[model samples]
Target: MDKIVLKNMAFYGYHGNLESEKSQGQRFFVDVEIKTDLTKPGQTDVLEDSINYVEVYDMVASIMTGESCNLLEHVGALIADSLYQHFQGIIGLSVAVRKPSVPIAGVLDYVEVVTTRGQI
Candidate 1:
């Protein structure tokens, strides 16, 4: 199976268990991968024969922008569910959501989550 990967898509949003974290907001990174048959797109080389990743980006962006979910796991699962429900041909998908500059005293680059669905 061929894979399409989206890396480090960033967003600033209100998502956290703590009140301060939610009120202040924080940066989040999202990564996604989709498994598919590449032969059709490779043979025809048509945009329609394959997934338009721009749309995928838009979908994730919309999710981040439109709602406030307290858990990155929920956000990650939403992305995977969206892809799976929207595209039947997609054999499977993985989504990761990361939070950077967390409020805790300890230094950390980010907290990340990865969720996978379907056959891949």
Candidate 2:
């Protein structure tokens, strides 16, 4: 199996538990890893044979700005679901979504949600 990774994909949106967070908006960081059989793409050496990350980025960006998902967990799961459905040969995935501007009182970097697809 080969792994396709997309890291530090940043986005800004309104996903949070606090009132200020929803109204003010915040930054979210994402890291996604998709695991799949690579024997075919490895042999073909074609961009179309393998997963194209630019399309993946576009998909993620579209989702982040599209709807009113209230939880990062739900959003993360949505991404995993989309990848599994949209891209073939995807056997498993790890999606981590981080909220960097959470409205907590103390000093903190971010809160995050990690989701997996077709993972045992």
The C-alpha lDDT values of all candidates are 0.86, 0.84
RMSD per prediction, one decimal?
Answer: 1.2, 1.5
Which ranges in model 1 have alpha carbons more than 4 Å from their true place? none
lDDT of 1 by residue, 1-120 (tens): 899999999888888788887788878889999998888989998989998899899999988776788788888888899888876579888998988877679988778888999777
The C-alpha TM-scores of every prediction are 0.92, 0.90
Model 1: residue 27 alpha-carbon error in angstroms: 0.9
For this target, which candidate reaches the highest TM-score against the unseen true structure? 1
Query: What clash pairs does model 1 have?
Result: none
lDDT of 2 by residue, 10-106 (tens): 9888777677767778788999898987788889998889888898888888777767578898999889899889998788999999987766799
Which stretch of 10 consecutive residues in model 2 shows the poorest summed lDDT? 14-23
Q: Which regions of candidate 2 are displaced past 4 Å?
A: none
